[model samples]
Target chain A: MTLEVADLQVHYRTLKGDVRALDGVSFSLADGEIVGLAGESGCGKTTLGKSLIRLDGRMRHVGGTAVLDGDELPIGDDKAMNARRWKEVSIIPQYSMSALNPTRKIGKMIAELLRARGKSYREFKDELVRRLELVGLTEKVLDNYPIELSGGMKQRVVMVLSTLLDPSLLIADEVTSALDVTNQRAVAETLVRFRDMGFVKSMIVVTHDLSLVYQIADTIMVMYAGRIVEKAPAETIIKSPKHPYTRALIGALPEVGLEYGDERLQSIPGKPPHLLNPPTGCRFRARCPLASEECEAEPPTVTVEAGHEVSCWKAN
Target chain B: MGRYFRRKLLIYGLTFVIAVSINFAVPRLMPGDPVARMLTRNSVANVESSEAMRGYFNELFGLDVPLWQQYFNYWGALFRGDLGVSVFAFPSPVATVVADALPYTLALLLPSILLSWFVGNALGAMAARNKLLDNGALPIGYVLTAVPYMWLAILLAWVGGIILGWFPVAGGYSFALTPAFTWTFIVDLVHHWFLPFLSLFVVALGGWAIGMRNLVIYELESDYSNYLQALGAPNRLVRRYAFRNAVLPQITGLALQLGVVVGGALVTEVVFAYPGLGSLLLNAISSQDFFLLQGILLFIVIGVLVFNFLADVVYVLVDPRTRLGLEGGQS
Candidate 1:
């Protein structure tokens, strides 16, 4: 495994109380694997991605251990994590359009960042130019300001910059949500190409578009409130999801060849529960059609096959 | 860039034309007649002689002509670099009067306006992230900004001039000395200039500090700053970028605040009795010296416009986004 996250609990510190954004979540990524983490807007998938690399100010790492390549990550300590960031682990944040400094030239900003990190920009210049070209960009973009580039160009530039150091793990957070369908497909394919080229060992693609992530992810992990409801191969998760939440989630998507002339598409009956002071037992119990008294207690992660696991009482 | 500057110059030229026209019209529209006021100051009581003097004075000042002709003459004299003669200080040309007062005002205005902007932005940027400085300095800044220019001038005068006797409260220089290029006169000029400058500086400092603090905080929280921090760029590097970006808005703010600062300086000069354009303006208004008033107002208008133009140029140089907008062809 390239990354192993076990019993991770991250909380959001608010004036009201500590919001259990990520409560006892656990997952692992294999070498060269790209895992698509999918869920609704507040499902804590972004939190999971951020926690692995850099937790924001409001997020507190209550309990967790993320071991990468047999070395424990200092997830809670910012100073300790700084040494490993960008070089060991990096993130392609959601706001790639405005990620660059508008005042500084792209090449100069990159050089300054490199200098601060004790790396020589001149040494990396040729490789950087190659990667920019790989993403269908010219080296002339480095001389231009961020404002001069189109949104798609800026997005591609950010992609090249994030993986420039060949980090072991990359977290691409909703990177495709802002792009059009064609650009979205191109970006997703570019991510796979990066992996194939050994630019990144593994990646967690956190997104809400199930159909989109299904195209490139090796394995899909479906999360409900703050916990993963199912983990299976991409084909199995899309074709035969064991968890009701995952099934309903996949059911909501409109397929290419389907006709909905007579019947309307189905949506889940209720929204996910509020993470702050969440109800005891299964998080999806309130919204699950198959909910029963057995679901009042927490369901264990039961293995259906060698690699497939489902956290549901009816999965047995 | 050439087209952009040409357009700016065209706008400024139009503004000048409109402003000069208004400057000519305002004093004429006022209730008092400057020639009659001049007569009263001379204490010419006899009706026959007063009437003779009025006719001679009006003809001499070119006021005896028709209103349209007078307006043309006014513009004609302006183009010839003549500001006409002051009714308040008879026989002295308005240009000479204004010229005499110009240096004192410039000396007081330049250092105060620039130093406040620089020092305030630095302090505000520093205090944005430091809790102790923010808590301590922000409230003081608020209080300082809330204090009116004249009120603060009076307060400084009372404390530094009356209570302590550390500095002179009035005049551009000591009355005991003659005007000269010697060190003693220069020292006395500065000593008298200090209180008025301080009053303008203190009030403006507060406004700039408050503006910069808020701007820096916003920039630090911007997506670019967050991206840098997430990439593990050191705090210093991130803050340096934030400060640079934050200063862009403050430049525009400086342009917007320039008129207000100039107005404050005017009030400050009046309160301190400093021999600057403000005091000259007050005398012109009270004595109904139309030519002197017009001359002083024209200088102020031109000063404001030139400074605003300089700000636009500086903004274009510092912000690439604005530069792109100016070029108008790029994405």
Candidate 2:
């Protein structure tokens, strides 16, 4: 395994109470595996992705151990984690529009950042140019400011910069959400190319657009209310989903091959539970179509097949 | 770039014409006669003598012409580089009087504005992340910025001049020393310069520090800064970028505040009784010297316009965003 997150719990501190964004979540990524973390908005997918690289100001690492390649990550201690960041693990953040400083030239800013991390920009210049080309960007972009580039160009520049050091794991948060349809497919394909070219050993592509992730992801993990509802091979989860939440989530997607003469898109009926002082037992029970009285007690994550796991009493 | 500068120059020229016209109209609108005040000061009680003197002075000062003709002549004479003679100090040309006083105001203005900006920005940047400095320096900056120039000048004069007797309370230099490029004259100039400069400097320092503190904090929380921090760029690197971006707004603020600084300098010079443009302005008003007042106001208008232009240039140099705009490129 390249990455293992065991019982990871990250909560957001708020005036009302602690928002249990990620409550006792356990998952692991295999070497060279690409896991698509799919969920509805505010379902802890973003919090989970951010936890692997960096926890923002409001997030509190309640308890967990993230072991990457036999070494434990110091996720809680921001100061100590600096040593692991960029060199071992890196991330492409959500706001790529304003990622680079507006006043700085792209090349100068990258050189400064590299110099701070005790790396020589002169040595990496060739590789940086090569990777920029890989992302369909020209060498002239280095001389330009972020504002000088088009939105798509800026996104590609940020994408290249994030994985320049070839970190073991790259957590891309909504990397393609800001793009149009054509650019979206292009950026998505670029991500798979980067992984195949060994720029990253493994990856976690976090997105709400399930179809986009399904194209590049080896496995899919569906999260509902900060806990994993289903984990299986990408095709298996889409075709033979056991959990009702995952089944409904896949059902809502408009598959291109399906014939639907008069059928409207389906949406999950109820809203996800409020994370602040959340109800006990299964978080998705209230929203689950097959919810039972047994769901009042916490359900075990049971293996339904060789590699498929579902956290529900009915699945057993 | 040249086109951009040409457009700026055209705008500045329009401003100059309007400002000069306003300066000409203001003093003439006052309810007083320059010749009457000039002749009365000589105490010429004989009617014939007073009338002869008033006529001679009126012609010499161009007041004998109609308002339209005088306005045209003012522009014509300005093109010829003649600012008229001072009625307050009759024999000296307006140019010479202004020249003599210009150095003192510049001395007070330059060091105070630039130094306060530098020190305040540094202090504010330090206070942004430091708990102790933020708590201590923030309130002091607020109070300092709130105090007006006149009140602060008087307070400084009382405390630093009268109470301690550390320096002379009034005048630009000691009575015994004349204007010369010597150590004694320079020392006396600095000694008398301290109070007015300090008053202007302290008052302006607070606003800059507070503005910079808030700007730096906002920049530190901005997406770029957060991205840098997330990439594990050290705090030092992250803050350097934040400061660079934060200072861009402060440069624009400096341009907007330049006129206020000039206004504050006038008040500060009045409190110290310094023989600068401010005191000269007061004397011109009392003596009804419209020519002298117009000349001084003209100088002030030019100073503010030039400084604002320089700020525009400096902003372009420091901020690439503006530079791209000037280059006719979209950002």
Candidate 3:
């Protein structure tokens, strides 16, 4: 296993109270595996993605032990985590358009970043150019400013820069949301290609678009109300999902050529529960069709198959 | 680049024409006539001599001509670098009088504007993350920015001059010495200059601190800074980037402040009775010296426009976004 995160609970300190964005989330990624973390907005998928690498201001890490390749990550301690960041773990942020400094040339900015991390820019120059070409960008882009490039180019540049050091695990948080359908596919393919080439040992692609991730993810995990509901191989999650919430989530996506004729596509009946002071039980109990007395007590993660895990009483 | 400068120059040229026209129209708007003001300035014994003096002054000053001809003559003389003669000080050219006081105003304004900008930005950038500095700098910056420049000038003059008697209250220098290039005269000039420069510096210092403090804080929260921090780049690298970007807007503020430099802090000059452009402006207006007034106003307008142009060029060089726009327009 490349990354094994157990009982990771991260909360947001808001004016009202703590928002339990990621409560008791446990999962793991094996070597060279690409796991797509899917959910609705505020489902804590992005929170989980960020927690693995860097927790931004306002995010309080309540409890967690993330072991990557035999070493334990200091996820809660910011200063201690600094020594591990970029070298062992890196993140491609959601807002790629404004990620790089606007006033600094792309080359000088990257050089300065590398220098600050005690890496020699001169040594990385050849590989940086090679990867730039791999992303269909010419080396001339290094001389240009962020605004000089199109949005897709900027996104690709961020991708190459984030994984340049070949981090053991890369958290790609909503990397494709800002892109168009064509660029989305290109970016999705690029992530898989990067993984195949061993640029990143393991990857967690966090996103809301299930269909997009379904095409490239080796395995998929669905989350709701800051809790993971299901995790399985990509095909199993789509073709034979046992959890009621995962089934409804799959039902919401329109088939390639399905004609509704008179009936509309199905959507989840109700909203996810509020994370702050969440109800004590299965978070989706109020919204699930399979909700029963067994769900009143929080469900436990049970292995239904060799690689499939589901946290639902009905599914077991 | 050439196209950008051409467009800028065209705008500046049009502004100059309109401003000069307004300057000419403003003095003529006053009830008093230039010829009449000059006649009364040095009274003659009887009506006959006064009438004779008025006729000669009208011919000499071109006031007897049709208004259209006078307007044309004003432009004609302007093109030849002649600002005409000052009636307030008969036999002295407006250009020579302005030259005499220009150095004093420049001396007071340059060091104050540049130093305040450099120190305020450095202090503000430092205070953005430093809690102790932020707490004290915030309140002081607010109070300083809120104080009126002229009011501050008067308070400083009273306390530093009248009560304390540490600095001279009026004049550009002491009455004990004459103007010279020697060290003694320069020391006296600096001594008299301290209070006015301090007042101007302090008032403007507060504004710069306030602007830069807010700018640096906003920059610290910006996406670029977040991305850098996430990558484990040190705080020094992140802050260096923030400061460079923060200074862009302050450059714009500097250009705006330069407009007031040539005008020489009118109220401050009046309060100190310093012989700078501000006091000269008042004397010109009261005595209806149109040439002197027009010359001073023209200098200020030109100074503001030139500084604005410099700001544009500097912005292009510093900000690559604008440069990309320029290049994108062509390619």
Candidate 4:
């Protein structure tokens, strides 16, 4: 395993109290593994990704242990985590268009960035240009300011910049959400190619779009509120979901061949529970159609098959 | 481009017409007469009577014509650079008085504006990066910004000049040296200008710091900032990227403030006893020097319009989103 996270519990501080954004989530990714973390908004998918890289002011890492390449990551301490950030674990954030500096030209900005990491631009200039070309951007773009590039071009530039150091694990949070359909496909394909080229050993693609994740993810982990409800191979999770929450979520999606007249899609009944003082036992019990009295107690994660896990009382 | 120029030209023309009309009308409508006040205060025994003062006013102001006609005549005179003679000052053209006062105001205001902006923005950026530093800096800025300009001027004079004895107490230049290009003279001039400069600097620095700090704080919370952070570009890179993009709105705001700065320097100048345009305007107002006041007001109106135009151009340059109607440009 290249990345292992155990009992991760992250929360957001508010005036009222703490909001349990990510509660007791555990998962692992092997070398070259691409895991798709899918959930609705406020389901802690983005929180999980941010916890691995850099947590902002409000986010508090309550309890978690993340092991990357035989070394424990001290994610709670900002100064201690700096040594591992760009070189070991990098992230491609959602809003990549505004990521570049407006005043500096693209080449100069990249050179400054590389120099800060104690690397010489002269040594990496040729490779950088070649990589830009691979992303379908011309070398001339290096001389132009960020204002000159289109949205898609800027997104690509950000992508290339993130993977420049070939980190062990890359956490991509909704990277394709802002792009057009054509650009989305291209950017997604570029991510796969980057993995194939050994630019990143493993990746966790966080998105609300399950179909897009289905296309790229080797494994799919469905989360509800803050807990991982289901985890399996991409095919098994899509074809036969054991958890009721995952089934309802997957059923809500609009498939290409499925007509609305033939079979109308149904969205999940209620919204995710508020993390601030959340309900005891199962967080999804309020909306789960299959909830039993046994679900009043916290459901333990069960492994019914090799390498597949589900958290529900009835998952036999 | 032609359309934009035409629109701007139309605005400029309208502004000039309105300003000139106000300049001509307000003095006529004012309660006191410049000629009467001048004669009453300084006239000899022969010029004591109201009839004699009326004759002086009529001859000096060309008051035989109708008010509108006199206004038109004044407008024509303005076009020809003949802002009529100041009634109080002996036979000097109003424009000459303004011209003499203009350079000093510009010299003091321009450098003060630039230095405040530079120092405030640099500190604001640094404060945005370091949270603990921001906690200390933000309140200090608020306190400084809250201080009135007059009070700040007095405080600077006392603390900077009296207690510390680091700078001179008053005046634009040292009387000990000639106003020529010599190192000793330049240093002395700078030393003299320091108090007035510091006064304006302290007053303006707070607004810039608070504005930039708030702007950076808001920017730091934006998704764009998160994107930069996630890229592993380091703290400085993230700050520069976020601040560069976020500071666009504030730039236009700062430009608008420049117009206010030119007009609002009165209190600072009075407290410092500095002979800038603000002090000159104050003197003209107290003496009811209508023609000089009109000239100064017209000059200020034109200066404000020019600065606003420059700000618009700068807005277009800093944010491409403005050109594309994505961010800075208003609907």
Candidate topping lDDT:
1
- Every model's Cα RMSD, please? 1.5, 1.8, 1.5, 4.3
Second chain TM-score, each model: 0.95, 0.94, 0.96, 0.89
Output the lDDT of residue B149, model 1. Answer: 60
Chain A accuracy as TM-score for every candidate: 0.99, 0.98, 0.98, 0.97
Q: Native contacts recovered, in order, as a fraction for each?
A: 0.68, 0.76, 0.62, 0.35
- In candidate 4, which residue pairs get closer than 3 Å at backbone N, Cα or C atoms, i.e. clash? none
User: Compared with the true structure, what per-residue lDDT tens digits does model 4 show for residues B254-296?
Assistant: 6776765555377767776666789888888888888888888
lDDT of 1 by residue, B104-146 (tens): 8778877888899999999899889999999999899999988
B116-196 per-residue lDDT for model 2 (tens digits): 889999999999899899999889999988866677789899999999999788999999888899999999999999888
**Model 1 residue pairs with clashes:** none
**What TM-score fits each model?**
0.98, 0.96, 0.98, 0.84
DockQ rank order:
2, 1, 3, 4
Lowest lDDT sum, 10 consecutive residues, model 2 chain A, at A282-291
| Candidate 4 deviation (Cα RMSD) | 4.3
Clash pairs (backbone) in predicted model 3 = none
